[model samples]
Target chain A: MDIVIYGTVNSIVFALIAVGFTLVYGVSRIPNFAHGSIYVLVGFLTWSFVNDLRMNYALAILLSLTIAAVVGFIMYRFILIRLRGMATSEIIASFAVSLVILEGLRMQGIGGFKGFIGPFYVLRPFIEGKMNIWGVFVDFQRLIIIGGGIAVVGLLWLFTHHTKMGLSLRAIAQDERAAMMLGVNSDRTAMISLSIGSALAGLAAVIILPLGSVTAEAGYKVLIYALAVSIIGGLGSWAGAVLASFVIGFAMKISTAMFGAVWESVVLVGTIILILLFKPSGLLGKQKELEERV
Target chain B: MSMLEVSSLMVFYENALAINNVDLRCQKGEITGVFGANSAGKSTLMYTISGIILDIEKKERMRGGERVTVLGSIYYEGADIIFMETSDRAKKGIILCPERRRIFPESSVLENLKIGGILATRAQAKKTLDYVFTMFSPLKGLKKREGGFLSGGEQQMLAIGRALMAQPKLLLLDEPLLGLSPMMEEILVRAIEDINETTGITILISEQYARPILPIIHHGYVLENGVSVLEGTSQELMDNPDVKSAYFGI
Candidate 1:
């Protein structure tokens, strides 16, 4: 039961990361490989500001979010906008940006070194208390992470369903040309979606940093897991991302416990391949040919 | 005075002139129908006027070195609008119900309408939504239906309905009656007339078949091989032997 709870908590955190990937791809029709870099950069920046400069945790998170949002906006304006209508070029450009960011972090002396901070010290005592059920001890941190993840997902679902901007984004995702004809500014909408997505990734980074020491190289691994989640979830769907994250998370944990850590990635890759073979669109993906029908 | 004026306008695609020194005008509250063959630049004219085709980026060269100018000027309510973006032009009441009935296919009918009303204030959007529903009563019943599932005729109605939601002063209809049953075509013609009569909105409709559109338009232009060879009132064009031979199959 404790193992189950741990898997559930880790699944939720990974789901948050996958949601950002799905959101940007859904609206912009770009894979956005640099998204994982943004996530890692934010975590490093937050660590630097809070642990090194002795800033408040709340202030550090806010500053990190702002920085991510600004970088996202500039990237869209200068790079992504020019790459629009060129899918291959856009994917290549995103990959290049990811490499640049990763190397930049290393050159700046923030890569491959595990850095730890205890900003959640106040909540530590409460979280340290264990709840035993069915001969299993569950920690409070897992509960908090699980609850927070669910809350974030719920809030995003509500916003996308109930808000005007959210509806606009969905409309663009469905048919960008039609959305533009209806007076939706594609550039502005893309910028807002990218900003929101980057901020969500940043928030997830902050939440996960306290659970383990963060390093720049951590992002690539997390990104691989997130991509697997995204593929299993359906590339452009929020609900699919969440569901896939849980499935992969649980599978990975179980596989790691039974076999070893090395088998976890192998299991994930195999599942994704099977999913693609059976249902190429992913679990929650809308019908691709429906657009051609109209 | 004309609501929109184009003089010596030239359009090209990779060194090939699609519209050559075309001159046209649309009067207020008048339906100006453009008649042309498939590649005679009818759609190109509409796209240029709507500012969809970027003249600068898509340019090769103009015949007279004018560099593919959209001369002399386009005016809406007597205001110069040559420099406005497509979205700004939409906000200023110039709307395009483009060919293919480009509705947001995955969105519900109501959501599609809301997208069209993006430029309006919240209160105004609500009012426009109500107005659109009234204009197309069938849309009110199918407000929750995804646009992709709608029939061709229904999608056409939704497209026109969406444009109405924008409260357009000048509406550009590119092939409004294309690919419709005879009954559907009649209904569309009547609906367009009703819109013009009630709202006093000016409309420019381009059509290959002049039979159905000639009776509805106030004036018409006949484009042949990328040039405006004929221009007159609808009745005059209907009687022209050249028009009869080229378009009407008389």
Candidate 2:
């Protein structure tokens, strides 16, 4: 039961990280490999602010989100915009940016080191007690993670579905040139989407900080898992990503329990390949229609 | 007064000239037709006038007298607006219904129309949408359907309806009758004429087929290899010996 709750919490948090990656790719049609770097950078920045500078946890979290948003905006304006018509170059650029960011952090004495910043006081009480349900003892921390994940997902859905900006985004994602011709500003839309996605990732990172120590390279595993979930769910569909996340999260947990942590990634990778082979359009992706549109 | 004036307009692809020393004019409330064979630079001229092909890199190669051109310069209740972004140009009553019926395929027909009316206020958009629905009543049932699912004729109607929602002073229709059956072509031609008659919007249509379009247009130009070889009233062009031998193949 404990393992099950842990798996659920891990999956939800990981899904949020994946959502950011998926949203940017969906709208821009560029595989943003640098997204993983952004996640790790935010985690490290939050840690440095709270532990190194001894700042308040709230203030650190705020600063972390702000930094992530600014960086995302800058990357879009400087890097992505220049490579707009060249998609392959844009993907390569993102990969290059990820390397620069990761290496820069390492050179600055922030890499190859594990740092645990805070068992944030506000969240400490949640993990203090455990509840027994159906012969399984569920930690309050795990419950909070799961509940918070659902709330965030619901809010994201509302924003994407109900808002005018969200509607514009969907239109742009469908046909960028047509959207531009229709007066939808692609740059502003992309910037806003990237910021929102990165902020959500920052929030998830802050939430998960208490569960484990964070390293400079801590985001790679989560990145891989999230990408796998996204591909399995469908490239641009939010509903697919969420459902895939749960499947991946649970599957990983069960596999880890049965096998070991070493073989867990292999199983996840195999499952993704199988899904891709069978359902190339993904679970929720519109197969024939969108391809023709593109 | 002429609504648009172009003189000695030259366009190039890489190093080769595509449109060489092209000059043309369109008067207010007139439907001008540009007839050309494949690769005759008709589309290139339209793209150049619409500012889709910028002179950023090609400025050095451009050379001609009276090269200065004015687009959307006609006084519409006292306003000059030739230099505007495509969307801004659209808002100020200069809309282009591009070739291939460039509809937002993934979007619903209603959404596509709404996007076309993006520059207008919400109430204005609503009113314009209603006007579009009235103009293309066949589109009323397909409002919720995605643009990709619509038949070619329906998509063409939706494309024209979308341009109408912009409330244009001049609408550019690039090959509206392309890829349509004879019946569909007739329907589209009638729709185009009806829109012009009812709204008083000036139109410039580019086409490869001259027979169907010549009857509807007031003036026409025969373009061969990017240069205008013949310019006359539609009836004169239709009756001209050279036009008959070269274009009409009659």
Candidate 3:
């Protein structure tokens, strides 16, 4: 019961972290490397608003998410737009942006603001209580993560499948020229994607960061976790991402329960290596052979 | 005045001329056909008129790949829109049913049409959806089916239906009958005629085999190696010895 409950919570956590990354890549073919920085930025922004500015907690989160979205729009419009098609340059440029944002947060003497360098910044949980499920004690925040993950996935499905803008986004994803022929503007869709992706990263941060402290190092760790889920699930494959999250989540949990906590990272890395060696495209990923056959 | 007028149009991909100094016109509410063999620049001409070439050109430039150059004047409804963005052109009612039926393979047929209706008003989309079903009844049954799984003929039907969803004023069909059976070809030819007659939409259709298409077009142009070698009415093209021998398999 404990394993099942905690494993689900862990999987949901991974899914939340990687969903934003997968969305941006799937829609616009852009690997937004600043995803992690955006996550950390939102956490810090919300913290600063609530603690430093003494604003309402809910209002602070809303403002933080909005800022995250604006950041994404600016990142794509100003920086990534120039380096659209070149894959290597895209990665390098987005990574550079991530470095600037993450490192800048820790830099001293920026507008008389002290650097966010400690493990003291933490988001208060939405509801501070524990619930018993099948004899397993699970916190409300973890339950909220599971609910939020499901809601995000469901809402995204509806958006892509039903709404006009969402349908255009999918159309562009499949074939940009074809979409354009039908009047779907590629640049607009890409900008919308980046904005939504950044906001999602911020949403994940606020939902998950409540469980732990917000640190600059957490940004890198979140990015690695997101990347691990993406790669193991096959990059840009949503169903594959969710599946890989569960796979990694359970593997880490089982290993920790059996051997020790030290085996957690080992299991995560080992699973990624095995997936790369065997099915590099992922279990549910769209295969090149299938694309050619179609 | 013609719905679209192209004058001295030239397209080059790194010094290889794909379309060379070709001029063509599509009269309003009339069917215009361009007949050519493989590599005769039919698709290139379609891309240029629909402004898809600009996108290809931009992408090529971005990748440091081929240097695509286009020199021409395209007057659509008396406005020079040579350098208009493809999507903007689409918004102005220039929609291209691309070659190979580039339907959203992952999307259902209904979703595919809905996506094509992005620029349409709500009522227009609803009416067109009904009209598409009436025109291509096979698509009605396959509304929930994934586009990739449909047969080539159905895909072509869905492609045209999808284009209609966009409410195109001047429709461009690039090799719409590329790999279909004779029966499917006939069905599409009839459907094209039907769309032109019912909606009064100007159509510029390109095909390698002119047998099924030549009968429907009011005016026809025979392209040979990137140049418009001959231009005439359907009867004129069919009666000409050269067009008869080369295109009609005489």
Q: Write the per-residue lDDT of candidate 1 for residues B116-201, one digit (tens) a residue.
A: 77667788778878777777788888989999899888899999988887778889898888899999888888888888888899
**For candidate 1, what is the DockQ?**
0.34
Model 3 RMSD in angstroms: 1.2
lDDT of 2 by residue, A262-291 (tens): 988787887788887988877777743367
Give lDDT for model 2: 0.74
Off by over 4 Å in 2: A1-11, A48-60, A106-164, A237-239, A279-294, B54-94, B166-169, B242-250
> Would you list the clashing residue pairs of candidate 3?
none
TM-score between candidate 1 chain A and the true chain A: 0.88
Worst 10 residues of 3 chain B by lDDT: B241-250
Candidate 3, residues B1-250: lDDT per residue as tens digits?
A: 8989999999998999999899999999999999999999999999998888888998899998999999989999899999999999999999999999898988899999999899999999999999999989989998899988999999999999999999999999999999999999888999999999999999999999898899899999989899999999999999999988886668
Model 1 chain B weakest 10-residue run by lDDT: B55-64
CA deviation > 4 Å runs, candidate 1? A1-4, A107-136, A257-260, A287-294, B55-83, B245-249
Candidate 1: tens digits of C-alpha lDDT, residues A1-294: 656877888789889788887888889887777788888888888877876689886788799999988877887888888776566877788778877877676673355553433333211122456677678776666666777788889888777765778877887887675566556677788888888888888877777666665666767876787778888887787778998988888887888888989997798888889888987878776654244356
The list of candidate 3 runs beyond 4 A from truth reads A291-294
- lDDT ranking from best to worst? 3, 1, 2
lDDT of each: 0.78, 0.74, 0.92
Maximum-lDDT candidate:
3
Could you tell me every candidate's TM-score relative to the true structure? 0.88, 0.81, 0.98
